[model samples]
Target: MDNMKQLIKQFSALITLSLILTGCVSLPEPIYLTDEEVSIAAKVGITEQQYRVIKTSQLYQLSPRQTDQYLRILHEQEPDLRKRIGRIAEKNIGQPYELYLLGEAPFEPYDSQPLFELSKSDCVVFVEHTYAMGLTDNWGDFFKTLQHIRYNNGEVGVVTRNHFTEYDWNRNNNWLVEDISSIAGENTIKTYEQTINKERFFAKQFGINVPQDNVKTVETYVPNEHIPAVAQYLQTGDFVNLVRSTGKGAWVGHVGIIKVEDNGKVNVIHSASPAVRKEGLLEMAKSFLAETPERFAEGRTATVGFKVLRLHETANDNLKAKFDGNVPPIMMLNRKYEYLTKEQVKTKLALMREQAKKDLIENALEQSKQSDIK
Candidate 1:
């Protein structure tokens, strides 16, 4: 205790900025630091006094407890993989809700990095964590597998972040997801161009001023009227990404795995705004429209096009492994101190922004061909 204070007094000018840049540590201001906190800060090169916003961050952790029965079903006896996925979500019912998880740096517009926090999570984080847990029994492999699923080409950086439910991840990770949308099938489905407000979205998340050309529009779906047909085909363990209106923020508003009840009722087990929870697929759709009647005018509403995706057995087999329940000791830290390529950043950013224009142009060209025939 005296040793920590002495170091603090000696290096009074050194602020928490150093620790903040590295990752998370204790004490931003000149205050008493506990032995554990002091050790962590010292190990990470974080110590100083200033405006402190310190709190416990629950990431890259094993669950509070993984029951033997849960383990047996998930890792051993469960014959059906979908049921296994639902069971994994069932184990994590009461975990707390955490937001701004990816934004943990001293500098503004916290750079993007692959974060694997399982103790607590928000909606999408909940789904990602559950999937990781369900797949890997070992924490180390879980972190590696998570990186494989969360980024492009399994590379880590701010620009490599994959958030889009329809295009970004769905396009890249064929091993993890099977696209059941109209494009992948022979059937013709209703589709529309969603103009992504990149400026508004990035400004809010990354705190960056984006160019007009950076905004993208892509051919996506509302699926307001067709959720039932889609839901019928969905089974347990299916990854359901609720693509909502752009006015809200990002394209994916909610995410969860499908759970079929004993009585044959199908529900979405997800973590939402208030907390992590489950809802009947039909009920979820009804509530979305009811909450904002003006958004749809007068019509039936379901989750912003419910992106029903199925996980392949090969991916699941590779991801799910035996666990010793040990925390991964080594992780790539010092992300805030690292630099990312601008061209790669812009290329990734522009890919998201321009999807809509390309779709619209193609649609127009098709219409013109029909007009000539008439």
Candidate 2:
């Protein structure tokens, strides 16, 4: 009887252990975004061109090999569009312009087509109409209209008249230029002059800014020539954004900026890379930013940096005090004014860094827990 009791107790203990092990084994595994996720991120909108690509490639029903081929073709075609637009810009560099189409291309069908392809004629008409109304829609035409323009020479004009009412010429170009020039030195024009300076241009072009600091700063193991000048604007506690270029050629393929974090590990906030939505540091850096380990190392070696400027106050203040405010008061000062105190910026940076560290740890633990369950 005693032996039997002991045997029964042992059996119970074994069963309990087995149950626990089974429970552990049954836990769910964490899911990470795959190449599909990255591909989804790359999608900008349901443009007509995208629809055409999708339908032509039969991506929805494609085999793995076919899908891969389709993606390759899409990537190859992206630069061709840019080249065509740049050719157009170059040809019309000095002309007082109106929108022109290469020829009468049929308007893409509305249902399956992307809205961007409403009509090539419509796009040209929009540009011409805006120009006539005294509004310059240069960036819109350049960046948005990719289909009608060919790879060869095409010309478009800048609006010279001030009589139009539909577009706000003063608000669009003159006011911002005057305002930025007033705050920044006159040389700002030579350095940062581009179509991107337009407010609508940047806002429409990019997505929402994350809740954290508009900018982030990071230190790389390698020497980056672009850092010192930008660093002057950063405070020790302030977060600074970062962007690094990726691609085999001279062009930058991928760009993202670092968000604030407490741990030494960098946290990035970006859209449409290896993953579509916003992600934490490890996933983002490991997946999208550093897709190729060799390329990542090479980028680290080159060390191009970035910082976001979400709010205009600090940037504007820095520009005013450093470049605009004091004339001849401080001779031998660097042409780029250094006015903000390090402490003011540092406080914000420290908070951001701490938040980042916590986020990373949470992400790791979650991943581990999920794996254990699986």
Candidate 3:
């Protein structure tokens, strides 16, 4: 019996070597849905064209119409909100990453970039879009919810956009998430204060003025040394802010979401330089910290800690109420409509830009005078 087993093993090794020498072995090809298969999967509201586009693409590649149908089906299959968020995020695991993907385009003509891009996303866009989709069941509601999360008071404009991470983003979306760093890492939590100067930032980045400077805010985070202990308390869909230190101070440099596996392993899902990816929490931290010496020697930033935010139990209900009257077929997307020639639109945009700069300068001057008087 032993001689027969050895012969079989030798024969299998010879066959493998022969195949390798002949170049007959290759990796398995990825399987994608066929056109007819996509047609079969298309629901009532999804068009054949839309279905075809998303047949081999991720969730981000789906059109608004297809999104509505997908969301309905998704909600039916996965009733748990946290799991839904994780699944929706996983669908875009390989989505290309791009910074500054959205702006108030045709709506305001201030930032001429399109309002939405389906192919790529940055860290903030990934998190915001994922949350928006998780909370709504239709495309129109998803758009409205996304707008609410992206801008202050749901106003779509350059100045209203959430620019300051701690000052604007955390404060504006407080209703959706709660800071749980203190509780989750109470034993090893650390706090840092940093000033966010949006006024100077806007002036330098966009050549646009602002009326006020965002004040300093205290942030609580769990230092890298304590991540292992704090990670257990983290649940799926929790927000993660990667904190980095500079000679000046510390700031929230990047962001992502948490997904705890059934096996009790914690992962951080984020969109970075190349694409959306998932990494074990400890593994990511180790990689970041391992490069600290080289990064500091090269005068580059290094991640020092993390701040986690717990999702609110009432997030969906609150957002639904806020978006009660803001869906398509009933909600008006554009503020006003007027047909204009291409040249006319260009002229109007130039005029609007100039007017916006003027208004910002005036507001800054008024605020300066008020500060002087005080």
Task: Count backbone clashes in candidate 2.
Answer: 30
Summing lDDT over every window of 10 consecutive residues in candidate 1, give the lowest-scoring window.
Answer: 49-58
| Cα displacement (Å) at residue 307, model 2 | 7.1
Candidate 2, superposed: residue stretches over 4 Å from native: 1-224, 228-257, 263-267, 276-308, 312-374
- Cα lDDT over the full model 2: 0.30
* TM-scores, each model vs. reference: 0.59, 0.21, 0.73
Candidate 3 residue lDDT tens string, 197-307: 665555544555454634768899887777888898899999999989853478898999999999999999999989999999998778876887788788888898888
Rate residue 130 of model 3 by lDDT.
90
Task: Give per-residue CA lDDT, model 2, range 200-309, as digits (tens).
Answer: 22122222111222322222211123333233332211222233444321212222323333443333322231221223444443343234457656663322333222
Ranking by TM-score: 3, 1, 2
For residue 25, what is the lDDT in candidate 2? 37
Model 3: what TM-score? 0.73
